[model samples]
Target: MDRPRRIAGEVWVAVGVLAMAGWTLTEPAHPAGFITWAAAILVALGTAAQAVTGSLRWWGGRLCGGVVGLELVGAVGDRFGAFGRPGSPAVSWGDWSHFQAEAAQLVPWDRLVVPAAVAATVAEVVLGVLLVVGPWQRWTGKATAGLFVIYLLAMIPGMGSASILEYGLPVLIGGALVSSARGDRRATHQSPAVGRENTLAADYK
Candidate 1:
């Protein structure tokens, strides 16, 4: 990315991280809350570093990947009642049964709900790990994007009651991951060619 655009993106990311940090700190005191706040701070620092050095590809992939990975894993935690009871404000589904119930609302077949919920949970965990670890980003990013697209379509039935963040944010982040992956691929393809050209020019000089 160009310097101006890269700086602008970093600024926005930093602002987001700061906002998350602020929110996390304001939440009821809990060990997990502190951890989340710390993570947000780290991301903010990473964003600042990238802004100063203008290293978007390296930092950008990790930033986007880390944020998405945490979101997926944290969601799974919420479903498992890690944060609070199922019906509590902090919890989403709250347990396997609750998740299945929600799945039933979206799944056309009742028999498919259990398996679908299980598969989704497993996929989210695996994808979350892959994204956080930074291996196979191109394929993982593509997969994440596909997953979010599926989520957006599934939520159409409840769009009237759903918050914009519920249906929109994930899709936006997924698109960013896909775009970043493509940028990485292009950079990979051009590097060796650029290197070869530089070597030949030096030989002539």
Candidate 2:
């Protein structure tokens, strides 16, 4: 089950990278578009890092966590830089506000959208770090899963079917990561017992 989930996660990450490539090809020839392109690539890298390092937990966590940390930083930059609008001269609070406003339309929390977005951003950075340096696997994995679920839901509205489809693969990858996290933690817990059994068999031989 763990192997299958890891494989699926890898495939999903590859699909996400390809989808972002296609988006790059089709997007309007504008500078601001690069921000979205870069963000997608960073996310794909993080997903792939988690998928590939099935055995090396520490390094895997670092790779995945670092990329996500960078991603959150980029997102914060987008908020202030107006998502790098071509003509904007300074921080574009308007762009950030517009984004949360659209999300407000879908959920019944109009007043909470801004606060939620802010909290999510901060959570992303903190959780990403904890995933890297902490021993709390289940907790970090659950938090990451919750964050991606919010992202998936917020994406459904104001996007075309194709765009939505492109985004869906990442959600699947995130789910796979969550499963892998649990599986890995269990494996870690059982490894010492397995080692002891092997040692006993060798002694008997």
Candidate 3:
């Protein structure tokens, strides 16, 4: 895609994600949440596909990374009551205690809850940052896929009623593809000599 079209696609995908996030915070269990989530995933899937198959691979990677990063940070914020008061209808897992209660259902051992929650929180922030400001997109993307897979498996006991699958599955697929795809060759392989020449020309001006 050309630069303008590529930018438009990225913005569209970002808006879709933000819409889903907003809807989720206000009405996580609402039936419409599924529709919005699915629609966003569809848009994301198309953009990601175009990126992988065309010259926009770098842009695609950043898009996926940004979405995932924002999701992680936002979820962490929700856990800490950043968006709303704990136990309020406007928020999900409105506080750390509330989040732990939800986590307790997925964790097998009582002893593991605190440690697991702590580890997961720390991982989310670190990985989220790395994904957004990536020096290693490929590895970070794979790690993100792994994290989502773990979450999916943890939800198996409630698979019959799970809402996570609506977004989780697509994210897993997107993360895998982002990990495997190559970045833009021209951007990665630009000559240092050419850059130095540009610097010299600017200096003389």
Who wins the TM-score comparison?
3
- lDDT by residue for model 1 (48-123), tens: 5444422354565467667667767887897888888877764667887787787787788878888988899999
Candidate 2 regions with alpha-carbon error over 4 angstroms: 1-5, 28-61, 80-99, 105-109, 132-135, 161-205
Q: For residues 125-159, what per-residue lDDT tens digits would candidate 2 score against the true structure?
A: 67656654544544555566567656666666744
Model 3: clashing residue pairs? none
Model 2 has an lDDT value of 0.50
Would you give me the overall lDDT of model 3?
A: 0.59
> Best candidate per lDDT, number?
3
Residue 16 displacement in candidate 3 (angstroms):
15
- List per-prediction Cα lDDT, in the order shown: 0.56, 0.50, 0.59
Model 3 residue 30 lDDT score = 54
Q: Name the runs in model 1 displaced over 4 angstroms.
A: 1-54, 158-164, 175-205
- Poorest lDDT segment (10 consecutive residues) of candidate 1: 160-169
